[model samples]
Target: MDSLTQTIYECLFGAEYYEVNPASDDNTKAADVLRALFSANEGGEHLKKSVHDIVGERGWTENLAKAILGGIENALKQGAQMGKTMADASEKAIAEAVGFARDHPYFCALIAVGVLAILMPWVLEALGFAELGPVEGSFAAWWQSTYRGYVTKDSLFAFFQRLGMVWH
Candidate 1:
């Protein structure tokens, strides 16, 4: 029953499932309270104050408590289901994306080029390649300027022309 209570504590408060960190006062108190209420071995009366404090609180009705427990149980189940669904879909989507990229090299290349056109400036500045000024324009205008500026440069004109051939 302590295990069940600990699971409930974790599900409700995002506490660590097993190890109750002694370093954290809140974790210790939470662990103690759970043990006080639910431990079959040596608890409850051991912290007589805690049990009294809980029972003394208003609206400690059995029906309300049961309802709250049901809600928590439902939420944990729904969260698990959502996580599993996302995991399954993401695996399939990534596999399909990899296959598509392999089959359509040119299309993938274009996407890469377009992404680089938009992101290169930020990446360059972040990596200390260039000291870029703050950009002030609509994102579309910024992307167009960045793309045209880089492609038209003497350093990369030949590379841009090769990419243009793929576009043509």
Candidate 2:
């Protein structure tokens, strides 16, 4: 199975990926030692036995030296896998975010508004947009105009009525 599928399977099913350590050169195998250190009341005896099995499988006399070398090789391979996994995961996450934005435009607009509010000052100064407003007919006066041009004052009452502010 692919490494990502194997990892997900282990996470979801609590299944052992190996009865003993696989002879794979993945540095993450050494991470068991770190996990043993941080996990309270935990022992890495299983991992030690696995390493010993690895050494014996190779007919190595010195367990510690073999384990160290194997760990370095394991770490190197795992590091490459980790980098690829991160890049792939980031792409998927971005695609998911785009999907979410498509499904919920109002929520996305609110988020955009909040971000704009926070960055408005820097953006205004950088783009020199602060000097423009609809008061004298700048883009800032966007609320007063449409793509077809400015709305006439005759529609003011109609606009208020559309907003549920009708006066009898």
User: What are the models' TM-scores?
Assistant: 0.25, 0.26
Note the Cα lDDT for every prediction shown: 0.46, 0.42
Q: Write one digit per residue (lDDT tens) for candidate 1, span 4-55.
A: 7566555644543324442333443444443443332333354566645644
Worst 10 residues of 1 by lDDT: 126-135
Best-fitting candidate, scored by TM-score: 2
TM-score of 2: 0.26
The segments of candidate 2 whose C-alpha lies over 4 angstroms from its true place after superposition are 1-82, 121-168
Model 2 residue 104 distance off true place after TM-score fit, in angstroms:
0.9
**Candidate 2: worst-modelled 10 consecutive residues by lDDT:** 159-168
Over the stretch 61-139, how does candidate 2's per-residue lDDT look in tens digits?
A: 3433344444434443454233333345545877999999999997786566446545553432232233332234444
**Candidate 2 root-mean-square deviation in Å:** 18.9
Clashes of 1: 0
